[model samples]
Structure formats: C-alpha cells, structure tokens
Target chain A: MNKLMVYMFKNFIRMLLLLLFVSITAFILVSLSPIDPLQANISQTALGSLSQEQIDKLEMYWGVNEAPIERYLAWVRAFLHGDMGTSLLYRQSVASVIMQKLSNSLMLMVFAWIISGGIGFFLGILSGMNRGKIIDKLIKGYALLTASAPTFWLALLFLLVFSVWLGLFPIGLSVPIGMDAASVSLSDRLQHAILPAVTLSITGISNIVLHTREKMIDVLESEYVLFAVARGEKRWEIFRHHGLRNILLPAITLQFASISEIFGGSILVEQVFSYPGLGQAVVTAGLGGDIPLLLGITVISAAIVFAGNFIADILYGIVDPRIRKGARS
Target chain B: MDRIPILDIQNLSVSFSQYVDMFRKNDLQVIKDLNLKLFEGEVVAVVGASGSGKSLLAHAILGILPYNASFSGRMSYCGEPLTQMRIEQLRGKEIVLVPQSVSYLDPLMKVGFQIRKSVNDKRSKEKMLQTLNRYGLGEEVEKLYPFELSGGMARRVLISTAVMDSPRLVIADEPTPGIHIDAAKQVLGHFRKIADDGAAVLIITHDLELAIEAADRVVVFYAGMTLEEAQASDFSDESKLSHPYTRALWRAMPQNGFRAIESIKEADL
Candidate 1:
C-alpha cells in the first residue's frame, strides 16, 4: 500500500512537470509566430479610418505590450486559477468556448474508443489463438486495408452510403443545429453520431487489432503459458488467468501512446462530416489566429495525454508483480 | 517379485511435417523406436547430450508436444492405456512436470499463487507452505516474483510446485543446470525423497556423474534412441557399460580423463 502511494505520487509529479513543459513550449511557439492576434483582429474588423491611439489601446488591453515571457507567465497564472483567458476569435472566455465543444468531441471519442477497443481485443485474441488459419488471414488483410486507408476518405464514403443513399444516419453534428442539446433524446444523439464515430474508429480498431494480435501471439508462445498448459490448465483458464493479463498491459500502453494520432485523425474526420466538436473548433481557431483559444486547446490535449500515460503506469504497477516489487524497492 | 510399472512407453516415435518448398513436404523424425518403463520407488535418470531428444521424451509423456509433431506410440499408466484425455485428467494431480527452463515460471504471478494454482482450499495451501519449507524457502519468498528469485531458488520453487500434490509420476527435464553444485545435489536429493515415498521419478539430464550418484538406474540415449539401460553401479567401470556410445560418454566425463572419441554418425550407431 505504501509503495502504491509512492508510485502514484511520483507519477503525479511527472505529469505536472510534463504539462508545465508543454505549456511553456506551446506558448513560446505561438508567441514567436509571424501572426499577431491583436493586429490581425484589428485590421480585419476596423475600417481604414482607425486611429493610432485606438491601436495602442487595443495592444495595451490585450497585454501585447508586455514581454513575451511575462505574458506567458500571466497566462499560466490565470490557467492555474481555472481561467483560460478570453478568446479574440469568439469574443468570449476561452474556457466557455472550449467547454461547449469539449462535450461533443468527448461523446464521439467515447463511442469510438469503446467500440474499437472491444472489437479489436476480441478479434486479436481469436486471430492470435488460431494463427495462420483462415480467420487469422482474413483479419490480417482487413487490418492492413483499414490501417492504410485515409480517415477523411472513409468518412466521405460512410456519409455517401449511410446518409445520402440509405438515409440511415444524419450527415453531421452532435445535435441538430437549432435544437437545444439538453432536450435531445439519447437515441437521437446516437443517430447523429454513428457515421462520424464509425469513420473515426475504423483506423483505431485496425491498429489496435494488429498490435494486440502480435502481443498476444508473443504471450501465447511464452514459456510460462506453455507450462500452464502442461500443468493441465484448461484452455480458457490459461487465457483468462495468464494470457489476458500479460496482453492487456502492453495493449493499454499502446492505446495511450496512440491518443495524439487518434486525435489528429478525429480532426480530419470531424471536418469532413461538419461535426460540432473540438476538432472543428481547433481548425477555426487556428485559421483565425485565436492564440488564446489555440493554447487552451493544446494544454487540454497535453493534459489528456499525460493522464493517459499516468494511468497506464499505475495499471502496470497493479497488474505485474515484478514492477510492483521494483517500485517498492 | 514383479512389481507393476507406474508408467510404460513402447515403440514411441515422433515426427514433424515440414514444408520443404512451395508444394513439397517432408516428415522429419525427431524421436524414434523408443521404449521405457518406470516403477514406483525408483529414480530413473535418462542421461544424454543436448539434442538427444531427452526433453522431447518428457514433453511427449506430458502430452505437451508442439502442434506439428505427430506421435505413434503405446503408453500406459498403471496398466491402463494412457490417452490424451486421460493424461489431461491425471496431469498435475497424478502426474506433474518440472520443466527444463526456469522461464517456465510465470513472470506476472507471485510464487505462492503459482504453486497453489487453481486450488485455494486450506489443505492445499498448507501443503504448499510445507513443500516450500522443505525446499528451504522462507515465507517471504512466496511473495516474490519469478524474476526476483535466484537460479537455485527458482529451481527449488519449480520442484516444490511439481512435488506439492504427491503425484504418482514426476518427469523433471534438465532441472539442475545453472545452479550451484551443492544446490543441484540438494534438488536431486529432493527427487530421491519423492521416489523413496513411492512416486516413479524420471530425471532427464546430461550430467552423467550426477545421474550415477542419484539414480538407481541410468538410461543412456543417443540420436533419439535408447542405447543402454543399466544399473547406476555399472557406470563405475567403463567395461561394464554395454553400448560403445555409453562407454564413450563415460570416458568423456572429467573424472574419466575426458577422452575425446571420433564423431559417430547416426547411421553407424
């Protein structure tokens, strides 16, 4: 118990440091870019009659007159206090804009993640157990095709088939544009999400299936598993007790490591389907030079990545006694 | 007095089907024309050099051979024909194996949990603890993982796991390599004790000296065939050993002047 506490504490500290480093890097990169948020907004919004005093006032209001490092420190301080600053693009608090879109993306990701993980894990075990058989070969081919296919193209194909031709699912968005999301039924939300969620999950499922299949094959061939069989352990008992536990740790680590790529793919899928998710929000923020909004999104994404790896580490300590012993020592 | 053998294997042959080309296939025979029997209250050490099919013989009896390997043999356990289903039923209770590699221990499991396996009853737990104690392992060692154990400790744990159930037949495959000499003898001594308690123990090893010291009878194997089966006392003199290969092996022992013999081809043997 003491060792577990210490392990969690250490992981927490590492996550905090990683977030700090990522925030600093994101802030510095955005600050050094050619685009200036205040100037960009002013030139786009103002007519030719704008005065120099007005320009200076806008710069002062946005804290652009301060040094870059000072501005970053101020942003960090506000972020630590749960204030993500104001967005020049949306004319609202960055937190509010992000919070509004975060739910949509979270819904899509939750569906895709659960569906892909379940299908991938089940098929991986089947293919691994019956390696070189017909089912294994079929899954391998499917994995190859899906892993290489472009996400946007797949989304367009789904939209063409399911929305335009069959009319089975809505083409885009988490909820209908004019309807209040709170009043929407759960089934309606699901109907709208099916096309985009399936598109986003195809690649994730293929990648996980391939990774898990390979790992399970290695685990099955391990000497201990063979010994378990020789000890008269039932086939299911060996898989349940020995095989699955060994396979799950690496599979989870791979899942967490692929989060960024999954997020990147989600953006392309969202844009193709016109989904009202954080992916679309990030696209608009980038094109509009919404620095505060962009930085806020980057920080949240970094936090998710850090949390994923942190969870994997804790789970490693829990599932594998060798690691737990090492941590305790 | 004719005592009933606990395990009997007759005319055992093992071969694997390998694809030689895109279309052609060949059968590679690994073990052929093998026969052996083990009676209760005796330790039979099968001694051979590496690649002599000793371990395969052990795997064959345990019914854990690789998928491609095909076996044609007659085997019986206590006068009943031993089928695959019967072996599964008897394994780990009536019969058990001490595998060759210490890697056989699961890295994810604690030593105690692995030895107890599926049985969590009070009697099984007490028996496990007693077995571990007999092997000189402390209580704390039960909580340690396989990687945490020293080579000797892992060997002892493997022995404890095999012998805990008081099996009728025990097949140990090269269980003493990579441990201290004294520790090796101690492990063999434990197997001897098990045999003395009436279980038929088969210890497969390449160490002729150790076999001669611990076994009541020694079976010498060459090129997947048994060359000679003799009392361990016969190994005291090279002339008393029957086969030429067995005599060569005795000469090759360090205590026997380590004489180098010309390579004998399988066809000649």
Candidate 2:
C-alpha cells in the first residue's frame, strides 16, 4: 500500500510538470504569433470609429498593453484560484466553454477509441494467426495505406461519399442547424457523429492493428506456445489459453498510448466536419488569439492524455501478475 | 521379460529442406536411422552432445516438426502404429513432454492451472494437488507464476505438469540444463520414479554421467545417428561397449581420467 501511494504521488508530480510545460509552450507560441488579437477580432471600421482615449481603454481592458511576463504571471495566478479568466472570442468563462465543447468531443473521441481498439484487435489477431495468407496481406495493405493517409483527407472523402454522393448522412455539424436543443434525440447526435468518428477511428486503427499483429505473432511463436501445442492443446485452445492473455497487455498499452494521436487527429477531423467540439474550439481560440481558452485547453488535453497512460500502467499490473509482482517488489 | 515395448521407434530419419539459392533447395539430414525401444517401468536416455539433434527425436514423437522438415520412420505406442492422428489424440493425455527450458511454462499463468490444463473437475483438481505434493511442492506454489520459482522448484513444477495426467509415456528434453548438480540429480530421480511407476520415460540429454546413473539403457548419438545402444551397466567397463565412439565417451568421463583420442572431434566426444 505504501509503495502504491508513492507511485501515485510520483505520477501526480509528473502530471503537474507536464501541464506546466504544455501551458508554457502554448503561451510562448501564441505570444510569438503575428496575428494581433485586436486586429483579428475587431473590424477595421470599428477601429477607425473609436477615439484615441477609447482605444486605449479597450486595449487596457483586453490586457494588450500589459507586458508579456506580467500577463503570464497574472493568468497563472488567476488559474491557481480556479479562475481560468474569460475567452476573448466567446465572451464566456474559459472553463465553461471548455466544458461544453469537451462533452461533445469526449463522445466523439470515446466512440472512435472504442471502435478502433475492438476492430484493430480483431483484425490484428486474424492477420497474425494467418500470416502470409490472402487475408493477412489485405489487412496489412489496408493498415499501411490508412496509417499514411492524412486525417483531413479521409474526413473529406467520408463526407463526400456518405453525405454528398449517397445522401445518407449530414454534411457537417453536431446536430441539425435549426434543431432545438430540447428536441434533439440521441439518434440525431449519433447520426451526425458517425462520419467524423469513423474518420478519426480509421487512422487510430492502423497503428493498433500493426502493433498488435506483431505482438500476436511473437506470442504465437514463443516457447510456451510450442509447449502448449505439445501438451495436445488444439489450435484454438492454445490461442485461448496461451495467446490471448500474453497479447492483451501489449494491445492495451498501444490502445492507451494512442490517445494522443486520437486527440491530435480530432483537430483536423473536427475542422472538416465543422463539429462544435473542443478540437474545433482550439482552432477558434488559436486563430482569434484567445490565450486563456487555448492555455486552458492545453492543460486539460495534457491531463487527459497523461491520465490515459496512467490507466494503462495500472492495467498492466491487473492483466499480468508478473508486472504486479514486480511492482510489489 | 519379453513383453512388447511400450514405445518402439525404428529407422527414424529427419531432414530439413533449406533454400541455398532463390530456386535451389538442399535437404539437410539432422537425424539418420535412429532406433530405440522403451519398455514400461524403464527409463531410456538418448545421450549426445548439446545441439546434436537429440531434441528432434522428442519433437518427432510429439508430431511437431517444423514446416520444412520431413521424416521417414516407424513409431509405435503400446503395440499400435503411432500416426499423426494417433499422436494428436494421445499427446497431453496418454503422452506428455517435460520441455527443456523454464520458459516452456507460460509466464502469465499460475502453476496449478497449467498443471490441471483444461480439466476443471473436482477430481482433477485433487489429482493436481496430489501431483504437486508428490513432488514436495507446497500448495502455495500452485498460485505462484513460473518467474517466482527457484530453478529447482521450477524443474519440479515442469515434471509435475507432465505427470499430472498419469501419462503412459513421458519424454523429457534436456530437463537438467542450467540447474545445479544436486537439483539435476533430483530431476533425474523424478524421471526414474515416473518410470518405476510403469510409464516409459525417454530422457534426451548430453550428460552421459547423469544418463548412466538414471537410465536402464543408454543410446549414444553421434552426427545424428545412433552409434551405440548399451545397458547402463555396460558403461562400467570400456571393453563391454560395442562401438569405438562409445569407448571414447566412457574414457572421457571425469572419473575415468577424462581421456580423449586425437582422432575424435571434441564436439562429438
């Protein structure tokens, strides 16, 4: 128990450091960007109509006139006290905006994660067990092609085929544009999410498929597997007993580690789909120079990715007793 | 004492087809005309140098040769011809293998579950516990994974896994490697005990001293061929050995002055 506590404490420290690094990096890059917040958000006509004194007041209010260091310190101070400031673009609290956007993105990303893992694991097992066969070759070819293809390109292709050509699904957005929030059903949201979710899942699936296939091949060829066969175990019986558990750990590790990729890909996927998710919000904040919103998203996304890896570490112990014993020691 | 042998193998030859060029393939013979008989209540040791194709014999009996390997042989179990289908049926139930490395045990699985295999009946569970107890292993050892075991304990666990089904024939492939002398002796003794209980035991190894100590008969393999097969007692006198290579091996024993003729290759002798 004491060891577990220490391990958790260490992880907590590492998470804090990662959040700090990500926030600082995002802040620096945003600061260096040539896009001026005032110029990007306010029209030229509005700037021309304002008097010099009024423009000074507006600049002060926006914290544009403040030094970069003082601005960063103030933002950090406010953040420590649960004040994520307000979004320059949305005129709302950064936290609430993120919360709303995150819920939508979470639904989309979770669906993609689950679907990719399930399909990838199944395909990997098939390819690995029947290596050099026609099915293996086809799966390998598909995985390779999909892994190298760009996420935005795939999203456009899905949108064109499913929405434009076939007229089967919506072209874009989380829901129908004029639909009332109260009137929308689960089916409506799912119908809208299916395209983007599938597009995002396509890229995620290839990596898992390739990694898991390699791991499955290795497990099948291990000495223990040979012994299992020598023990009179049938092919499927050996797979059930010796192959599954050994391969499961590596698959899980790859699954969780791919969260960063999933998150990264959603940025492009959300843009192509025009979905009102955190990924789309990130682009909005980045373009409009909403530092508070961007920094908040940065920290949260880092935490989420780190949390995924942490869960994988914990699961390693549960899935394999050897790792658990090693941790105890 | 003229009863039919429990396991009979004759004129067994194994070869592998290897690609020397893109189109040309060569057949590399690994085992040639290897013949042996193992009766119930006796242990036969196929003694040879390490990597001398002794393991191929065990693999041959289990019907697990690789894809490119081919064999021509007659193998019978209990007076019946052992075909591929027959070996498949008998393996893990009537016949079992105690493999060479500790790695042969699945690292993720508990020892008890591995021993019991697919049988989950209360009677099989009792039998598993009895087998472990017979090997002087505590019940707690069953819950431990293979990595948690000491060398000797793991060796005993491997033996227990093989004998749990009360198999008619047990083939142990180089079971004593990487273990201390005393532990090695203990493992050999376990095989001897298994044979004494009316199962035929085939132990493939390179340790002539250990073989002569534990086996009823010893077969010497040189260049993948059976050069000599003699009673264990015949090793006591060099003149009693039929083959010149067998006499060279007897003289090479440490107790026999560790002598070797220049004509015999160091690897083979």
Candidate 3:
C-alpha cells in the first residue's frame, strides 16, 4: 500500500507538470486569436436593446478596458475558485455552459470508445489468430482505407446517408433542452449519438485492430506460449493467462492515446452535427473572441489527456511487477 | 517395468508447407519416418544437430507444431494416440516441455509468479517456494527478476518452474545449450531428479558426455533421422558404437571425459 501510494504520488506530480504546460500553451494560443469580444458584441445590435453608455458599462464590467495581464489575472483568480467566466453568447456562467455540453461529449466519448475498442480488439485477435488468412487481408485492406478517410468527411457522409437520406436520426442534434436529465432516456441520447459516434469510432477502432493483431501475433510465438501448450494447458488458457496478460501493456498504451482520439472525435463530429458540446462551444468562442471560454475548454481538454496518461502510468506499475517492486524499493 | 510405455512414437513423418509461390508451392518434409519413445522411469537423451527435426519431433509430441507442418504416424501417451489429441489434452497433464532458452520468461515477473502460473492453485506458492529452496536458491530468488540472476540461475529457475507440479514426463530441449559448464551438471541433476521421481524425462542435447553422464539411454539423430539408440553405459566407451556419425562425434570430443559442447553444427558444427 505504501508503494502504491508512492507510485500514485509520482504520477500526480507528472500530471500536474503536464497540466501546467498545456494550460500555459493554451492560454497563449487563445490570446493570440485576433477577434475581440467587445468588438464582436457591438454588432449584437440586431437584438436591438443597448445604447453606447450601456455598451461602455458592459465593457468595463467584464474588464474589456483593463490591461491584458491584469485581465488575465482577474480571470485566473475567479477561475481558480471555479469561475470559468460568463459565456457572452449563451448569456450564462461559463461553468454552466461547459457542464451542459460536457455530459453530451462524455456520453459520445464513452460510446465511441467502447465501439472502437470492442470491434478493433476482436478483429485484431482474429487477424492475429490467422496471420495470413483472407479475413486478415480483407480487414487490413479495410483498415487502411478507413484510416485515410477523415472524421469530418465521414460525419458528413453519415449525415447524408443516415440522417438526410434515410431520416433515421433527428438530423444530428442533442436531446432537446429543458427536458428533465433523469426523464431523458439513455436510448434516446444513444439514438441521437449514433452518427457522431461512428464518425469518431470507426477510424480509431481500425487502428486499434491493426495494433492489437500485431501484438497478439508477437505474443503468440513466445517461448512461454509454447511451454504452456506443452504443459497441456488449454489454448484459451494460454491466450488469457499468458497472452492477454502480456498483451495488456501495449493495449493500455493504445487506450491512453485513444483518449486524445476521443476528443478529436468531438471536434469534427460534434461540430458537423452541432451537438452543443465543447467543439461547438469552441467554435462560438473562437468566432466571438471569447478568450475566457476558449481558454477554459483548452485547459479542460489538456486535463483529460493528462488524466488518461496518468491512468496508463498507474496501470503500468500494476501490470509490470518490476515497476511495482521498484516503487516498493 | 510398466506394460505400456509412458510415450511411444512410431514411424512419424512430419512435413511443413512452404509458400514458395502462387502456383507451384511444395511441402517441406521436416522430419521423416522417425520413431522414438520414453518408458516408465526412464531418462532418454536425444542427441542431434540443429534443424535435424529433433526440436520438430519435440513439437510434434507436444502438439504445438506450426499449422503448416503435417505429420503421419503413431504418437501416444500411455497407449492414448497423441496424433489426434488437443494440445491441452497431451501436454502438462502427460508431457511437459522446458524450452532451451530461459529468456522468454517475462523479465518483469519474479520466479514465484512464473512457477505459480503453470500450477494454478493458490496454495501452490508454498510448494514453489519449497522447490526453489530445494534447487539451492535462496528465497531471494523468488523475489528477483530474470535479469538479476546469472545464466546458471536463470536455467535453474526455468527447470525449477518446469518441474514444480511434478508432471509425469518432462521434455528438456538443449537443456544446457547456453549454460555455463559449472551450471550444466546442476541442470542435468534436475532432470535426473525428475526421472528418479518415477516420471519419464527426455533430455535433448548435442553433448554426448553430458548425455552419457545424465541419461539412462541415448538416441542419436543425423539430418532429421535417428541413426542410433544405445544404453548410456554402452556409450561411456566410445569404441563400442559403430554408426559413422556418432562414432566420428565420439572421436571428435578432444578430452574424452566431459568434453565441452561449444556448438552443434553438423559440418563445421
């Protein structure tokens, strides 16, 4: 337990460093975008309410007149206290906006990951079991084609075929707002999620399939596997006992990388379908130069990547007894 | 003596498929009409040059031979035909193999984990620890990784792990292939113990001296064919045997007693 704690502590430090590096980089990049929020807001005259005095007060209230560093400090202070800044477009707290969108993206991410990992891993195992069989060849060919097919393009194609052509879904939108989160059924969200999930999952799943197949093939030929066979241990025993345990290391590393892939899914598929998630929020923020909103999304995305990698590190210590011992020592 | 041999192989011919081309591919006959066996309480030493299908014969009996390899003959465990049995049915329950190189063990895992893997019962830990101590390794060996040990240590660990469950037959391929001269005796002693435990042990090596010292019987292979089979004491005197290959091999050992086998090449071997 002490060793595990040490391992966890080291991992925590690593995550913090990664988080800081990402947040700083994201803050700089968001600040670099040329659009000014106040400048974008004057044109909201189409809503036809505010006078010049009212606009000036609004600018001062949000610290638009303050120096860049002071404005950054002010936002950063509130941000540390859970204030993500107010969303100008949504006319709501930035935290509230993200919370609403985050769940949708998370649901899509979870479903897409399950689909990609499940299908990819199964095909990979089959391909591995038959190194040069026709199925292996066909899967490889298909994976190659899918890898080259971009996510946004795939989303558009799904939108055309599934939504537009067949009218299978609600034309790529989230669950209608103001509905009770509890009464809003799981299957209903899943129904809205199919095209976006597929748009994201197919390529990732194919990549994992290729990787897992190669890893399984390599592990199958090891001396322990032969030893296991000679010991009269069943084929499945060798696979699960020796093979799966050994293969898990690389599989998990790929899983860590897939977290980023999941985020990438949201950007393209979510934007294409206007699912009102982080991707859509990012677009709105970028268009209106909402630096605080963009910065918030950027840091959260970085945190997710850092957390994914941290989980991988913790798993490494568990799976590899050597590392676990080292931590103990 | 037992009425049925622990294992019996009769006129076994194993062939492997070679995907030479699109149209005219041919099968490579890896082993041909080979016959060998291990009897009750016997230590049988198979001596051969590499690629002579000695290992292929081992694979054939183990039922882990590649899918392309096709074999025809009688191979059985205590009267049951191994030729058609599943790998799980034939191996470990009746026959267990300790591979030549000890490198395949997960470098990260300790000695205890590798041993306990084959013997799946939870209480096997105590038995494994006892076996490790019996092999003259301290309890520290159980805690150390493969890399932390010497070549001799790794070989012993491999042998100890193999015989943990005391299975009926243990097949050792080139058991002393990469072991130090000091470690070869220790490794061979392991097989001798297995055979003494009333389990048939098959030792595969090119070193006739080691075989003569360790085995009750010796089977010689030349170019994937068994050329001669002789009792261990008979080969102790080199002049008694007359197969040209085994004779020349017996002559080639510079120091008649315990000649070091640096390599197993056939020509320059």
Top candidate (TM-score): 2
lDDT of prediction 2: 0.90
lDDT of 3 at A258: 89
State the fnat of model 1: 0.78
Chain A TM-score, each candidate? 0.86, 0.96, 0.86
- For every candidate, what share of the true interface contacts is present? 0.78, 0.85, 0.67
Candidate 3 residue-wise lDDT, B1-269, digit = tens: 55788888899898988878887769888677778878878899989877778888778878778877888888778777765554456466556788777665765456677777745575787888788888888888877876677777778787776776768878888889866676788789878888888899998887777888899999888777777889988876777786766766776676664344445456531
Rank by TM-score (best first): 2, 1, 3
Kindly report the root-mean-square deviation of model 2 from the true structure over all alpha carbons. Answer: 2.6
- Using DockQ as the measure, the top candidate is 2
C-alpha lDDT (0 to 100) for residue A113 of candidate 2: 96
lDDT of residue B122 for candidate 3: 56
**How well does candidate 3 reproduce the true complex, by DockQ?**
0.43
What is the C-alpha lDDT profile of model 3 across A43-157, one tens digit per residue? Answer: 6554257777877887775456677777677777887887888876777887787888888788888888888988888888888867788998988888888888888888888
In terms of lDDT, the best-performing candidate is 2
- Report per-candidate DockQ: 0.63, 0.73, 0.43
- After superposing candidate 1 on the true structure, give the runs of residues whose Cα lies further than 4 Å from its correct spot: A1-86, A132-142, A180-190, B1-4, B19-26, B138-141, B258-268
